[model samples]
Target: MNLYPFQKISFLLVITSTICLLYIPRSLGAEDDEQYLNCSASFQCANIPNIGYPFWGSSRPNYCGFPEFKLNCTGEAPVISFQDKDYRVLDINQSASTLRIARTDYWNNVCPVSPGNTTIEVNHVEYASDVQELLLFYDCPPLNIPLPIQLTSQFNCSINSTANYINYFVTQNLTNSGLTNISSTFGTCNTTVTALVSQSASENLAMNSTKDNLVAVLDSGFGLKWDASNNLCKQCNGTGGQCGYNTSTAEFTCYCKDGPNPSNCAGKKKEIAIGLAVGGAILFGIFIGFYIYSFIQRKKKKLAALAQSKEIPTPLTSKSVATPSTNLSQSQSIPSYPSFTSKSDYDKGSTYFGVQVFSYTELEEATENFNPAKELGDGGFGTVYYGKLQDGRVVAVKRLYENNFKRVEQFMNEVEILTRLEHRNLVKLYGCTSRRSRELLLVYEYIPNGTVADHLHGKRVESGFLSWPVRLSIAIETADALAFLHRNDVIHRDVKTNNILIDNDFCVKVADFGLSRLFPNDVTHVSTAPQGTPGYVDPEYYQCYQLTDKSDVYSFGVVLIELISSLQAVDTNRHRHDINLANMAINKIQNHLVNELVDPLLEFETNHVVRGMATAVAELAFRCLQQERDMRPTMDEVLDGLRAIQNEDLGSEDGQAVVLDIRADDVGLLRNMPPPLSPDSAGTDKLVSSSTPPSSF
Candidate 1:
């Protein structure tokens, strides 16, 4: 084969051009991957019992998701894209309310190499980094490439900076304008369009109180809806929007209202009208101009006076503007919360717990610039810093990596979502502040005992898991909280050992509500994607996108199982079946091997009182894990059953210890117990857990 040098060189040139032209956009595309959520079946959203559009889990059902992005819960943790290349399950974020993931590296084939203009159909969630919560993107450079940030429709971030070592980061202070659509040249987006409906502040969803960070989009939509009452926005309902106030302590927005359009511009139309009316009148032109000018000046003065008189009362030397029923400022008089019914009273600091405001500078000093040392922990939303205010109270301050206006709405919900809330086992939200960029901070009575996971794993003051009485108390309290939520038509989705914090005496307090939803009768179970921790999650939730109070029962059941075994959710080294704590416990107990599955630390009292509580809890856990969601008991029924067990008092002469003076038929799901976990999305897997034990609670 003899070929001329020029001929060979020409062919090589063609190959080089082809490679560059093909790889450039795909490479740049990686830099802008702001894919905030790519859930598989394994990713746990304790709040969400099912998966839906823009989210793919049961990948086995079809090639769902971008191939290989299939997810499933492993009784330990949820696994994503299990057998595919770069198949890694990242994190379930409660804060910011987005699903974060680590993606596998692959080549994008722009088929029709010899021609052009190919078509790709998308059936799953397609997130264009240029149009979503920007902080969620990862390091997939050619590092630090200048990229455009896009959020929904009509909102775009034009950040054209050189990427350093990190991937494209979400610019803080980004606000949401109800997005509609975005367009790119040649369907590729050399430019994108973002639609901002009104001038509302950034809406930050409380990702998930205590679960992740209270900052995720709970429900976002733009269907056939509109609320033209207060005249706030058009084309959107005030349904999902939350109202929040700042340091001024006053503004109350129940939701958006109907207001006039650009024609409603302050002074524009009236001024023109007066000018016309006078000019046409009997030579009243000069008088009308002078009179109108004076009127305008007076109106401006009144507006200023109103602004000055409108102020939220303040504390002696702090930044808080106390809630004063009589002295609300004009600005405070404006309602910023969504139009949901008054769920509770957020105005009274005495009822619920809330946070105090600190100048950004003061917060900086308290946290030593949010130093890693003052850091208590890092969560899905951002980081938590422990600090002591000058008043001598030790507090935990959460600084969000991104801005969240939606979280403010939750504060409104805390104050007004439902009505009537009274429960000792639940954590109280005193107040909150979405000012100075931290965006969301909740002040609660800090509990010193750590989480239930700590005690159960044997990692706290007791130096071992709880005694039988303590375990009984914890179970009862947690159940009581669950019952309360159910009563209010709300579901505490992420109920687990970690979300259950203990105090010095081991009293349990249920925390976190980012995933809590108003389970109104009209709305069956919510159909968002599945969310929760790994090992302890429910299977029915993953199989169907319907979240009910029953789902919470399933997750709480996992926590009960964890309390019994004193084991972590997952241990990579054990047999797949044994790796699941719930499965392991059921198998051992069913085969009369209760001794093998029970935590030896609680050698306290296998007596009736202790055994009775354990037995009741185990039975309840078993029902919650029913293969059918309907088969699960409601939290109220669970509580009543526990109360009955408590009333029995396990056969004590004093009478608080008899094993239910009642019969089996009296119990519903608890009646004829089903076989333990059987192991599948829809089938119960017999229980078990791996070898390594996590810390004690």
Candidate 2:
């Protein structure tokens, strides 16, 4: 084991050289990391400071972070696009992995006046746990709820001046309690939307009850956390390597002292090895160029053939017609439909509603040339034909008669109203075709199940009787639809069983808005000739020329009574005293003879819960049928009452009589109701010219 002095010295020198060679890369890598991290210069946007990885923009390149997380500095604010929606970035905290964003449309107040469809679609970012949602209700009808609920940001909508300034109330709780209970607890409003608000902003809303405070809180926006995993960046920074991404491979790359590599600090020797490999690859690529070119040409041919196979045939027209981008333009040349004479005229009709204009040929093909076999129903103004479009969409095509000017007016009115209206419980108007035919045609979403009238007392009665629960749901849904309409300053004007269609699931879809009147936001009542079904018309409206939402409430009351008694609104077979359903229902309810009017199919006597719900409904119907317009309850109140009855029914079935404790101040139930008219008033019923006939379509 003895060694010469020269041999030991040589061994120690060899050991020292090996250790120095290994330590060189680590010390050099640390230096490289500092330079790489500087690639993403600390960016300052507005009040936000020190933004770097996971968010690249301004002076930073895409390789520094995710490309989708790019921010655009517009004016003094930094804007980011998430799922195609632009949001203003308020603050960024890299340590917390969170960012504050406010919807650009909301901040600018460029969104629709209604908040029903206002929703945020966050991509790769989630709302923070402390986020609070504020619900804004616009153009809501006057509700008789408690003062505190009513006082929540009651201000007129800038767009809808006719409306009693829109009411909005913010809530942290969204569970369904009862219709009136919830509407009263939360202001009676339509179109609910949730927005994320800061804890301080929410506290401000609670402490300060001013509209300015609400606007300030909403403008301040909410917080969102990102899934930014910075492990690679940290590792690269620690190793003295610059963190970046390989564009072609979309993989993280570390820029070291020597060159770029997939891992931290691959030193000078590896860089030289990579350079030699690159030179060899370049020479090999030159040799294979011709073969690669041939392969790409063949691939291109295959792609062209595939595209040709998938191409749809374009329609042929005389004189090389230019394709129209919109439905109105497609029908503009058709001289038969004079109503759509110009682009401006068509725009006036279809622009506000955003309804499509189907080509005449498309409708003709969809409806099989209006074949009689496809006919769904016939009405006074038009005939509805079932049709399946080329797109596999089933629709109801109503081909109007347009026999008179009045009929044409109705057709135009329906087109204008239905296009603007959107609700789950309301039938959707797909589009309209007004060319290549003598009559105007309207397309609506086809509901496979028949109308409430058919299911209850009309042709489809033999199919099966509706259960109490189904009937109750229809009532609540219909009420909700009406309330939504009223909130938007629209009156259905024809709320009847026939107008209430059902889907395959027995869900209500309120249809037929031909007679609907758009009450201006500033006007409480529109002065028009009274027009509605005879038995359902508000008596006050029948006697006077003025029309209000209460008129529809009267009609809905008749529909409610029909749900209970399963009788036609104007059934003659009933005793002469009970001919008009509204009048008869009111009389029976006042006399405490509601049980006698219950539908026999309901089997009310066998179920105590059913009996109580039926009685409660009858009372609600009575309130709706109040002779004076002022005495009638708002549709919001009606929906709440129906929900209360449903909840109570469900509760009773569970062996608990859950009395919905709706505060008296919330409900404001009418008392000391006027007595029903004597038999003489019924005998003296007179038809007036000012009264428009019932909806036949």
Candidate 3:
């Protein structure tokens, strides 16, 4: 091992085909910049921005990139992949400003020796794409967890035409925990991973090898970036902060940035005092207390009327839902409480969870004396206000607007509903206040991510589109929440992605239970007025007014369709013949033209997931759209089916042995697909309005 000989051997690592591939640079380090830009554009080779280190380009180093960084274009739909680990390639995430990739189970069920490392042991990854960027996604596994690893080192770009179809792969001995961000939506086995390119010769020869393992490439966002000398998020002269924009509501709050307080932002609301007397005159021992007390009471009355007028022109009035027949008195009519509770005090103090009543004066200050700027969103029961609590917590406060007996019933129902429910995916109700508004006021934890509808359609956000797999995961998680609701005998009369709010990690929470109903014992169902979105509304409910758990099922089916197509529930364009999504999907399917109904974003996806989505969603939408009240799957059954669809296995080795079909009698409204179309009638189906169908229909 002489120094001269060692240097020669080191040079050989690049030339050797078995391991290292020598990369030349166009600018400086050939081995670092160009290697990871192979998958920036199409599955084929394209002009990518060559950037980064430890990965060189195949072409010129300075002008374009280096040679080692050059990626190969394999198959008809050419795919960009790593030179050393051809099993993986770059996955472009347009929103996160980075690239992402999963490990390949190249040695499927064949490992010679186990890597004792418990963490995710991905030693080296190939950095090559048709395009280039400096962002990446990497969450390596720990070495301690023993994986049930198997090896079959088969790799060749030309071997599989649809190599990208294999999204998940198996590392035989790796525990479930070793898989970063592992979700139940995709199969649980480490075996769910797939390689970007295929290799036949390696697989054939590895059969007799004593030890074999698949070392795949991963293109996390950072792989597309170059070494930063300073900082990436640096501002020109001012400090930097996380992105945020909410002009529609004229409200925006970004993350903390550098300044006098490098880690805090501007916002404040005074706290309300606790358990203090309503009126006190200790300082007026001899100063004619009568005049002072009268003046204060008159001023208080005027202020009360003024605040109510600012937010609502009419006096505060609501029915006490607990006694649906009896309406509650307006706040103006209630006996006046003392002024001991101040707005400034409570604004700085955190509001307690589970039923904290805020005095009228305190609420006025929190909402800027009912300033128009504080409004959030309003609905059937009341208006919601986005306010800062005394404790410095941001909260959404729903103020009940009751003037009649029915409104009172609804108010009571909301209180009972919030108290009885608790789940990770449900909004948390902090204490409520009967004295704040006409009837009651409910405060909830603020979700920064906003509603699912905001991401899919809002014009303010940029990183909102959902990747295929991510959409599947969202579908499954939402189904789980609905399942919980059904299990507790609650019927979510209105369900839509708009009602589903998301969190930082993309967790889903169903909101706005304004129309929700509790299923009573001995009563299988109840009759109610028509509710829900126009297109998503159940035809049966409109006809007979009979509402059941299936009402929720129908609404969820519409959500599924919306997610897959990224289309609105209501498509009123005259160009589209005024056909709604339900009719559009049915017609397209009947014509055997499923492409017209599915999303275009999934054009590159392999396996049944892409093509199969139309069929699955169509079927669900069809069942939920049934014109008969007695026909349709229950929320429980729909949830199960949706979950199964979410965790579907694309690879040959993934599915568990079981049939998840709803039973013959159990299959209600969704029992059949679009009515069998006649050959001559397939071209088009007449569109119908939702109001055309009734419950008895």
Candidate 4:
């Protein structure tokens, strides 16, 4: 056909566009499939004889598997730096998408140069639920007092220990029930390491604690689940093709005998056909639209030139040649206001993670200008005030201190962490003002009743409203909330009776996230300056400056102690040696002087059931108060222990046993035991006031 210039240009443009679009995808797909033959061969090491897909090594290319899943087959078994740490892969279950791996440095020896926790940094990798952590304490000073049975399982790691220092290994199931009056004798350790082992293996090692047993556990390794390209791999295999990753495109690709396919081998030809057809149709439409636009622009210019030649500008001015100001004047003359729509009345509200964002004025009015009468209580970072929101909902507004750098950090940290977390026992976050507001304020659901501290020893102590059942319920709920927080990787650094709020209905609400921290997934603990309530702080955390969820366990231990004794955590009026409640608790429980610590109001002398429950709880508290963080049970363990003590069904299908040793009748037999050594004669009455034997609840 004899076509004009525009037609010829349009034809060439359509052909070029179609060619580039159709050729690029095909070329890329061809390049990606180059490794099809190479990846078809499975990876093999000495023990792991056959592994494929999502794990490439040695002879395999990068496109064969995920970058993070690459293995180093140079050694006897497959070695992979799964999460920035070298691990020896013992076996792989392709069907289950799991791996059995052991730490390389601790293969034979229990000591490592820079021992670290096994952390899963990649999204695809996760420790199986059946994995349990084993703790190793190294280079601890020999105690002047005899070591407790929990710490007696000593292994001499000469590399990390010396004549003056020794090493010890303990499992997660170990408790501090055997600890004597040795709280003062607990010494600091140089290095603490955490290792993972299968739950079955850990339970099996519960009775045996020799060095060889621990080394064998490390050699056996634990489990990990890999979910890389799960669906894609299934689809690829179903279509009789091999599944692989395309590093260039950062996507899953299917490899067939013919070539690489975007999805599956069976659809390769169909996909290419569709791509070409769609590209051609799109290019033809674009070509037609461009031609029409060019013609119109060209015709307008020609008409303007002809009008100028005829010296007639009226039609051009009236129809098309309007000045910028003239156009603006016409728009202004339109009836905009009469039919104008409003912008849906924004109440100056915003949302963060589904948490409402309030204005400064609204919060100020809700708090009645933060009146002193509205003051609720003081907190780690700010003061809380009772307020009612504009929506007629009661709330507790936390007004932080003036705009300091730390204040801003805490404000943001609380908002970010609280908004994402949802637990029935946890205090609900309603909203907060913007970071750029006149002042930073956080609004929470109002918990009308006072804190647990108020009932224990503060304003509400005389009421004796906290009975044995109520106290036990509080402990379970608090542990539950803390466990939920730990599961979500949150550590409530300041855990005390004061931080435990009691609503009007007596439900426990754990507040105060200012001192809480979002623990890093890569480490067992975070190394930071210890900041917690004085009597409730973890002694190990304070000494070593390492914070972990176990620190919360230690603090909760003090809270448990408070519930049983109704004694303040810090009582200066008592014996000088009994200043800190945790220290007094350790001494009394170890010396069989529990009779001295029980609150008289709990009726330890008459109620045998309450006595038994109290003693069992005391034992659990002692384990939590262990000088070593590893000796303390996890929050989940604490919850399980409490549930077991209360004889309540925990709703767990496995029905995990409580590790604590409780002796209900052992409480009243302390009459023959000698009195606790008192350093101050004047405080003797205060220490020995309660003669009723402490019992288990």
Better of 1 and 4 by lDDT: 4
Residue-by-residue lDDT tens digits, candidate 1, 1-697 = 6755455445555665565444333321233222211212322322344443223454323222223234554433344432232222344332222443322221121111121111111122322222222122222223222224232211112223234312222222332221111111111222111211111112332222221111122112111111111232211113322121122222222211221112122223344455445434523443455467667757866876776688633223344455565454556554476775432222222233333334454555655566665554454444556555556666555564332223344444654432245567766543344332334454444554457776566334244435555666677789888888887888876777777876555566776653266787787777644556666556666534467888888887777777776777655466655766766666666685665666666662545455656666677777776656788888888777767766666435565436433322222222233322222223211011112211111
lDDT on C-alpha atoms for all candidate structures: 0.45, 0.67, 0.46, 0.73
Backbone atom clashes (below 3 Å) for every candidate: 130, 11, 127, 10
Estimate the TM-score of every prediction. 0.47, 0.44, 0.43, 0.47
> Candidate 3 lDDT, tens digit per residue, 1-697?
5555345444443344222111111222223222123212122233334332222234322212222223443422113343234323344432333344333333233221221111111212223333211111112222222333332223322222233322223322233343322222232222222222223323422343322333322222113322111122132112323222111211122222221111212310000111111111222332344456557767868977888878744343353233444355454465777777565456324343345656555566666665544555555445666566677877766665432113334455666677677888787777565422444567777665556655555421254345555555566777778778878888877777767776656677777653377877678788654556667776556434577877777777777777777776776562343246655665565686666666776662454545564466567666765555457777667767766665564332345533323222222322232332221243321111011111100
Total residue pair clashes for candidate 3: 127
**Mind giving the per-residue lDDT tens digits that candidate 2 earns over 118-163?**
2343334666767765666664667555432323455445445445
Across 1-697, the per-residue lDDT of candidate 4 in tens digits comes to 9987587777879677967574634633454445677888886765687788888878878788877788888878889885368999888999899999999999998877777666554546776778776767778777553434444268886555577788776666534443332234333565556688998888767667777888898899999988776887888888867888765545678887657877787687666677778877777777877788789868878987998899876343445666665434554664555664432223245676678878888888987798765666654366777677777898878777551223344566778888877888888898888765767778888765557877777755553446777788889999999999999999988888877877656779888753477898999998764566668888778545689999999999999999999988887787757878998999899998887888988887676667778888999999999888888899999999998888843222456633232322222222233434331233221111111100100
Candidate 1: where is the Cα deviation over 4 Å?
A: 1-365, 401-422, 434-438, 461-465, 604-609, 649-697
Candidate 1 vs candidate 3, TM-score winner:
1
Candidate 3: stretches off by over 4 Å: 1-353, 404-410, 435-439, 574-578, 604-609, 613-617, 650-697
RMSD of each: 26.8, 25.5, 30.7, 16.4
Query: Which candidate has the highest lDDT of all?
Result: 4
Clashing residue pairs found in predicted model 4: 611-695, 611-696, 612-696, 612-697, 613-696, 613-697, 614-696, 614-697, 615-695, 615-696
TM-score of candidate 3 relative to the true fold: 0.43
